[model samples]
Target: MVVVIPKKRRDGKSSFLKLVFYLSFREDNPGDIPVTADAFFDRPSTSKIAVFDRLIDYIDRHASPESQHLITHLPDGSHRILCEGVLCQTNTLSIETASSEMNAVALKNTRCKDPVYHFFLSWPETDSPTVEQIFESARHSLKALGMSDHQYVTAIHRDTDHLHCHVAANRIHPVTYKVADDAYDISKLHKASREMELKYGWTRTNGCHVINENNRIVRSCSKEKSMPDDAKKLEYYSDQESLYGYAVRECRPEISEILKADSIYWERIHAVLIRAGLELKKKDRGLAIYDRVHPEQTPFKASSLHPQLTLSKLVPRIGEFENAPRVMEFKNEQGEVTLTNYMVSSHYDDRLHLRDHQARMTRRLERAEAREELKLRYQTDKKEAKCPSFDAKNRFRTLSMTFRFRRAHVCVAVRDPLMRKLAWHVLAFEREKAMAELRLKLKEERAHWYRAPENRRLSYRVWVEQQALKGDKAAISQLRGWAYQAKRDERTAYLSDTVIECAVSDDIAPVELKGYTHHIHRDGVILYKKEGVTQMIDRGETIEMARPFENEGDNMVAGLHLAEQKSGEKRVFSGPREYVEKACSLVRDLNEMGETSLTLTDSLQQKRVCEIRPQDKPAPISFDSPNLTP
Candidate 1:
């Protein structure tokens, strides 16, 4: 077992130190005292009962059944106490009585700086010692520390993987009444730990001070071949260490040549190491390389690989070397040698924060890109899916029919399955061609408008008026209201002009709804945003866009309005009132005309409602001749 007595701190206010102070005298459980002892005291208990009560409470709260009783000198006046289970009960009354007895003796001597001393004796993770052995060890250690006759309590705590004991000693001796001195405490602990390690046949550990100084390197060494296997230990070393291990084992000669040569060129060695996935960093402990992929792993130490690679030896050969520009160096505090400053720059902290931010943004971008790719693939797959081959014999026989629109009709013979698909394709082709012409016409008109200085002046005057109204609301109340009305009027006119431009571009062709009129604005069309929804002007009033709702009552009204305007109402229905009232009339007429619907199902009529894709279209199927109808 290894024993450690932590360094005493001047800061007495720390909570952890306070816990250790109270835990030493606490009872393992409430009211469970050994039956063999006689209660005796020399001093009054009034001045210190509460201190002992709090100590017992800390123990009871953290206690288990086995370590509750206090072990002490046998009442038979023998040196050894029974260590099986029972000691004095650690409850309030018993603790108070013991403190009074100790205080009575302490009153005879001068007060000490610390009246209580605590020690921790920890064993190996694999070992499980009995309570008797642990108390015995604590007894022997106390004797070694020259506190053999002092009254003390030992509690074995088994909460961690390693079993340990906390021993608290009252500095005042019961007989001598001399305050205990802790001079050379650390050295005594080291000697006692060595003695116990030999006695228990457990692995020995150096004093805590020595173990911490070497960065816990010696602690990793077991009494047996206690270090973890090479693969596991390598994780604690830097990437350079791993590469050094491999290189020393695999290519020792080349590395030796580079190290021994005067006026060493680092690039040559760096290039060689980079090929093997290694890069050197001048660290506080000397040259090391961290793994590129697992930088959290400790860097491999070059000196550890071979003594010649030590900073003292390597620096002489390299001579007047300039370290990597980004690696800052600082003078050694001990005046030994220069060392790399791993934590010197304030900007490095900001850089780390920025790197974390960039990493989060990169992950978001990757997810967004993945979603977009999936959407595109889905659309492509849907387009590539072939329509179920149309059949005429069992499903629908070909029939000569006349399809009529207002003042226009066509007669043809087609199977029901093919008829819907054929008509949709014809309409799509016509619409695409008309939109192309519309785009060209819009470009020409925009050019013409920009060429007119009067149009530009009018736009600038409107902007200036709006800005003036916004600057001082109180001064321009009536003018502001008038300006707002004028702005609305201007927007309405712009929307109406856009609709006229569309009409002129397509040569007054009837508008077809392909669901593209919402959200997006083409060259000749403008969609105004309002109340988080897209809006457009049909006449003078604002109309909410619903281009995709083709079979709805509102859509039918829009289509009728388009068709009637194309024929003769084009010049007459220019104002908002005329356009809105005409649309209401169209909706009434359409409702009176009744309704018709074409329902397509998945299994039998899946592809009948789709427009044709030119690349995947089958050979043209000729229609049978029929008499024309109008």
Candidate 2:
């Protein structure tokens, strides 16, 4: 069992309505709320609660009638509602009324920042609990958290591999307007999960709290053993074992045995570690195991692998620290190490390319460092030069003006008009030249002082994305691995699949056509925008509107046409009957206008030619044709 409390939005704001809406629908299709009105109204009720009745009434009035059958079917042939409302308030209120009341109560609390608590409880795939069991578990978990009296909305979602229930509880009490105490919520949730697992005889899962031998819940003291954070993230994103993890898994037992021997020596440990492509070295105040192949990467802390490997412990056992030999021969042949930088094992060529790119980046970083040093040197020189202060410079300028005026007076005192004029001219030329030189010097100094450094470096993920955009298969694979690790929804997963083959063509490039602007993303995902609004997304193999709008039919037809133009092939539009009909109608219109020649084929491969004849109107397309597949 896993219980997760999602963090609040980055802005630290909570909206009950938005959370409810998200819980009520599938991530891909927001237009349809999968919960039926009947199922919602059939929920257990303590009284004819006005709030609950109001919410049901609202759903009945606005919810789609066809939503009653929106149950999702698995490939195994079992069907279940994608999302079902399991429980609400004891008074049985609708989602809208509950949100409204919760928002109203939240307004009374001026101190509380986050007014909503959104948490989810999930069971393993092996267990398939009924709706009543799920509801009871949610009620039990909430009651254990001291949120029994608070307004909350709970729904069961079966869209994923595991069965899970989402609970959105208002932190502020509806009547008292006091925020619920959420201290130790994680421990409380874990305790609740343990209880539910026991009560239902479900599969047991580890948590922070566990039942002791005395049959009482106690805080678990067992240390959680796992890969290092960086190593774990690398494994997750690259689908390869990290160097630290590899050392721990493959080399730890032998190293531990060596440490356990009667005469523990540093040579024996170093030999074993080296055989595994690892080296033990002193780092900081402790020892660390560094990857032999990629020394630039982070190393594993010695104590993290085994307590006895610590510098203090090992020093006491072996007398003192001893460095490994520069070269050593092993009786057994050394096997090749699978781990590399970022734990990338597959796609060796791509790995080499990435390494080369990183090398270039390292050179860039070196240049940036050199520039920084130069900048600092320039700053130091400027400081040591002791340039004139602002006040001193102003005073000097005044003195110079006074000297010039005195010089002019001296020229006038000569009592020769021609000599005085010539002296003034010479002084003006000298002053102009001096001012120009000063201006040029100040401009150069300003340029040097404000020159920005080229220290920008792209992160690994961003670099991979850039490579993927350039149609690198390995980069695309790495991105897909990341998406898989993220557990993105089905639509996003499909979009992240193998990159579609896109033939280079100037016609398909980003440009405005018939008021719609086309934009292509990585892996040939095309987006059609109009007036700065995204209208549709064409993922080469599939096309979907961004949202349902009045002109969705037009957008759909336009997307199909654009996709065809880009692919240089005839495209078949497959979707709801209405959308297909609209596309066929548009195609017929285009054919009748003598602008494009096209033919519509039925399911039986019978093609109907659309011929432009100004003398007679064309026959209307038959939707009820027996041969048509719509």
Candidate 3:
């Protein structure tokens, strides 16, 4: 597995944030991971002035959906996880690319040994930490890490019921007021998480590393096949008078001492042969042939055995032999034997972290694009029909009627089928994301109503209109919230351009970044860093922004200023005593007029109750119309 300790550079930090928030993905995505930034943010609903605050609030919410994210397996057997998307990042991120706020995280005076800001962890959808469980665990972990900032952890979009938890952390320790170098015992966090995953019965695999230099290559001999097999051996070559004299004088004593440990070690003396110009490898072994004619580069001929001796001739002359070795021996019919054996060494390889990071980025982007595509499915008009005849106050009473009028996607059983209907669950979150794609078998008659010609339409206008009925003020507030959120998102997009710098491991050449290395030590990389000259992220980078001119709030006195805003009307209505006193005569008249309708309804209900008392109560209420809309 590869874990990257990203360099703490302000420029890189900018790009990191930018890549995270400006993320894009296809709304029709079939895989997981949010590629585009919008998948993590809420659409803007508030005025530009408040959008930043709305975004920040969202980021802090610790959002969670029914299932956290979708997972896609790559061809190489790795995976990508697409977490639920958001409408904005302003709620969680403090750096405003805009002018009103300081980009404190991007300061010049800050020491940045550890600058980890936001974290988004995802796992396969097939296995997971339950939404509630994840919420608790994430909160506990973040708090244990000493991050009490509520805004830092969020379980967003649970209402739409997609699963995903996000944390936006400040790398600097608030209490110590020290920048976390990330060189600390951060493994403890992952270990603890693994323990928790085990406790919760979740599957976990921390993937593999993929660097080019960590693998092996083959080598070939310079004049291998051209030489005879017998010519490949060079036992008696050292027996030559001059060679034997030089070896006895310069090396025989040392060689004899080493041979004391293993007499057969000479069988594996290929390395020595190569050095003395008698052996060559078979493939492209990263070494070049120095001289084909050199005895050192070519094999020694067996015919050149010293003293012109043969095995039988030498053995008879040498007489008795001691220490007959435990070599691999084969017996003939007469029990005479011959011996032979060979050996090779054993080792494993390693990979690079940078290569892994780039690969991960690529896979992540692919899955993100898919989830974004699904998000656009929401733009289609597939909302359940509303029953104007029935009041929401008694939603349950119209169950039967709703059934009759229900759309294909609508279901009304109290039983939660989330487990059985994974697609339905997924779509629920996608719908909340807005203006995304959802594939559906089209109803020819309903084609015009769907967003795409193949299916149906979901209108942004209609959603707003229906919610508007909740309360004029509430609707307006929600709208403004969305508007404000959009602005914050634009600001966060600025962080994607920062530059980051980190070095290669010492055992590896600097060229390893773009080339390759062969050595693989038992110990992994020893991280050494070059601290940047700056100490803090610049907060002033964004402070110059003026108050939004177009979205400025009403400036008149509180009550009057709110009139056009609609919320003012609610405030005035709360003072019923004063209004009632002013309209006392009108109220009296209205009370007398309401008795006619009230009396008629009461009489009809009484008659129905009397009739149903003898049998069953009549269906409590009629269903809303099947073809109705806001």
The backbone clash count of each candidate, in order, is 10, 1, 124
Compared with the true structure, model 1 gives a TM-score of 0.32
Tens digit of per-residue lDDT, candidate 3, span 329-435: 46688986543342112110111111112223333343234323433433443444322332433433344344334323445432457643665555556553422
Candidate 2 stretches with Cα past 4 Å from truth are 7-11, 14-17, 29-63, 68-92, 211-217, 223-244, 253-265, 312-316, 323-483, 486-630
Q: How accurate is candidate 2 locally (lDDT)?
A: 0.58
**Given candidate 1, what's the lDDT at residue 241?**
27
**TM-scores for the candidates:** 0.32, 0.46, 0.24
The deviation in Å at residue 165 for candidate 3 is 5.3
Please give, for residues 353-412, the per-residue lDDT of candidate 2 as tens digits: 111122233433433354345346445644554333335457448656965986768676
- Weakest 10 consecutive residues of candidate 3 by summed lDDT: 535-544
| Model 2 pairs whose backbones collide | 52-93
Candidate 3 TM-score, C-alpha based = 0.24
Q: lDDT of model 1 at residue 317?
A: 66
Better of 1 and 2 by TM-score: 2
Weakest 10 consecutive residues of candidate 2 by summed lDDT: 347-356
